[model samples]
Target: MTAHSDSPPSSSSRRRTAKKKRSSTPSTKEGMPSRSPRALSTSLESIQINPRTPKTPRSNDRRWPREDDVDEVELSLLGEDERRQAADGMGLEEEMDYVSQPPKKSVSSKDKSAIVLLVILYLIQGFPLGLALGSVPFLLREHLSYSQLAIFSLASYPYSLKLLWSPIVDSYFFRSIGRRKSWILPMQLVIGTVMLLISFRAEEYMNHPAEHIYEISLAFTGLVTFSATQDIAVDGWALTLLSEENLSYASTCQTIGLNTGFFASFTVFLAFNSESFAHKWGIPRLTLGTYLQFCSLFSFGVTIWLLFKKEDKETSEEDINIKTVYKTMWNICKLKHVQILCLMHLLAKIAWAANDAATQLKMVEKGLGREDLAIAVLIDFPFQILGGYVAGRWSRGDKPLRPWMIAFGPRLVLALVATLTVFWFPKPPITIAFFAFLVIQTVLSSFAGTIQFGGIASFHTRISDPVVGGTYMTLLATFTNLGGTWPRFFVLKGVDAFSIATCNIKAAGQQLSVKAAECVSEHGKQACKDLGGECITERDGYYIVSAICMGVGTLLVVFYLIPTARKLQALPASKWRVYT
Candidate 1:
């Protein structure tokens, strides 16, 4: 729990405490006394601004202010050296309360080993999530004849509805094993088991198209449901596993692990020829069952490996009640800033979704294949890592605002890169030019995206009320899904208008040709030849959709980013939050 005082402690009192603690410790080479963990913890706890409970008392101490009942900005009023000492003392074991100061929780090696095991177990579970979801579109397109829009619509359901059950995971625990681990381990087992079962179904259902679709949908839905549940558990565990000091770094490591799993399963392996595999296996027709079976086999292998891994053994009873869970969710809603930040996060993702949708279409229209898209994503990942690293480097100081500025200000660069690419892609001097443009755009997007997420990480952590961190993040996820989906919904609906307009224009041209032939017999051959192929009207509409969507999306980002940039720029360098 964070320590809060009604009034500021006197400088004399602070100096005396410092001197006494300093005298007890060994002197450094420079003759300055080292800081004690207790003092550092005290100072940090003093300024914690609990975002969820704003009515909680504020403090004047200089450590990195947590969002717990205390405010972080107030803590930045301290001298740089003091803040640095506090920050250094905070290692991976510290509590991350949005509304209170984080307490560094020290555990034995046994417990640490448990956390390590848990990480591995959860990572294994995350793999099939990526693979299954990523593969859905391809499977539907090839076997079910589902349109791109329909695939997008269908696969999006699980992620979009994650929040509905987030509370149950947060507050409710099993009576037997433990709240988090009990649920997590079993769920992992279920996923693996289901996946394995799904694999067998693939061979049996291939010939019957209707049966194939039904079985595939069921298996896919099961995977999504459990995958989402696993995500909840993992996120909660991540919050509880580390201490205040190491939370940032640990989270980064977690992200790396999660993304590695996600990319390998979803982005990389998804390109495999599952359709052909069915044929090779002598299946009469492609079945959804086969696809599930493949994914299940892979998932089961990982699940078996994870069952023996080290994981958290501790569980608490206080964490399992529905009433307690609702309280936590309600508490998260009480934090106004968290709500705003969630909205901002949603908006940012919306921009990204729009960009991604447009980019995929444009790439195909330009005659690029899936290989090119893969290369583009591969190139973008590094830039994102670089951006995250850069932001971490620049975030050391008393300035609380510097990181925000850096985070939100550069998004326009992404918009610019995306918009400009459309023009260059078509008229590029060579394919190399097209490749270069995409690579550059990918890098910029990655950089901006990294910074944006980094900012979110810091904000969420800083404002975190440890008890409710799970709920707060889940709510944030809910909003993010909403933001991402709304734009796509509208865009998909409007696409038909563009299609209809193009068809009408082309029909008009054909009518003109008929009229011309009737008026002049000599020109009939020329008119017929002109109308024989190459529908110019259709081409124009295609270009218009590409151009208009990009133009509009980019313009929207520009407006949104300007104020965000200005605010971020105004933040002081010293107070900028740093996460590794």
Candidate 2:
């Protein structure tokens, strides 16, 4: 009886020990528990033993796939000391990769499309400038004096002052259509309509330009004002449209497009109006009015196209008030670079101003016809385009504004050479040699000017903060325009100051028998008689003006630009902000 009772208790204790062993031995399924208290305890213990095995290794492998994979293979072959050394090597490689690898550029298709649109919009911005500024010298040469034409420059005042209201454009925008489009579309339409209205009366004005000079000036001034407003919007849109990498080309588009539009308005328009060419080609004669209407139609068509397009909503939606605009403007003005840039703008283009104002008049005075002027300008257009493209490419890489100082030397040299041409070239009935000389000079100088302008424009685009793009760019452009415009005032005054008096005998009605030449005088001044209605003036003023301007520009470049460029090179690129 004692033996039977001992066997039963021992068998029961053995069964209990087997159950405990089964629970202690880890099974794959023990980690995955199902609704049992004993299984839950086993799962908890299993998790504690290999806590990092499940997740930490997998994440590390994924994070550093190549390094980790190589590490695992090497670790298996290595002893503990070797494995530790290999791990240290792997960490060093990872750090080097992190330091050396360039950040991936993520340019999208949308960004490309936006750049194309910017090119077109910039073209449109350039379209009216040809008529307003480019064609003014040629068109007014018949009826107005050089002084009168220079005074007409007052019309461009809006371009400089547009910055005053640029804050308004930035702060308030049409949310429905887009911040840029709302202003761009309406202003474009207005400019087109104004051009059309002026076209209806353009012939009348042309026939009697003297009588309608003030009226024409007033009318064109309104057009320029509207166009300047449109420019503000377009500039702001460009800031939002392009990525930082693509900003270098912004001025390339501006230079090419603007020159193309100017060529059409100035050179092509003059060609169409050429009496000799019109007679030869048998093309139907069109008045200036018709051309204006055509431009207006084009403007309207572009406006319609803009309606179908969409812009990115990258602009900040901060509650923009007048006070905010003022504060931002103030802050922008306070930047050290901004102050220097303003002074540069005021002086940089003085040489260009003298050349631009005096070149056409000099060519005309040298007996070149309107058709000759047109052909010269046409030949110049392609070179300008080429220069802009080359400069844009040079500026696009790691180096940006440094190329401007290099281009400055060539630009100044060309201006000086062109000034000398005025004195050396003979008057009307010019030889083919003279014409060739003029063409070559025009081509070379246009190229250099375009390059210089492109660099300045790219720099402006780079520095402008996107949040206040319109105000910022417009401010820079305004200074540039002011530099270009103010010199004209001095140039025009100098033209009159240096003019030599010539007497007209035919108008005086002096008899052949008279003892002395009866010179005609009007209002206590000798009446100067020359071909093409307006009396020809000597180019002495132009030479002096160009020399002085070029000298000052050279001095500034050496003293200001060289130092500034070196300083800019030393600074980190991150210090130059594109967006606020």
Instruction: Give the winner by lDDT.
Output: 2
What overall lDDT, based on C-alpha atoms, would model 1 receive against the true structure? 0.45
RMSD of 1: 13.6
**What's the distance in Å from true for residue 51, model 2?**
57
Worst 10 residues of 1 by lDDT: 39-48
Model 2 residue 132 CA deviation (Å) reads 0.8
Scored against the true structure, residue 415 in model 1 reaches a CA lDDT of 51
Q: For residues 1-580, what per-residue lDDT tens digits would candidate 2 score against the true structure?
A: 0000000112222233223222422222332321111100000000000000000111212232245445555565777666556657777564344334457477678677776776677566555666776665566665555556666666756655665765566545545566678779999899889889989888787756657768888887887778767766675565446554444344444444545666677778877876766887988665688888988998899899999988765322123455655665677687776777777767766655677667667666555777787888777655655675676676654456666768777777777777777777786778888888889988877676555555655665555553344446545656755666667767765654554434323435542221111111121122233311222232345566667777777887788766776576456533534332
RMSD of each: 13.6, 22.9
Q: How displaced is residue 135 in candidate 1, in Å?
A: 4.7
lDDT of candidates 1 onward, in order: 0.45, 0.58
- Summarize candidate 1's per-residue lDDT along 545-572 as a digit string, tens digits: 4456555545655676446644544544
Pick by TM-score: which candidate is best?
Answer: 2
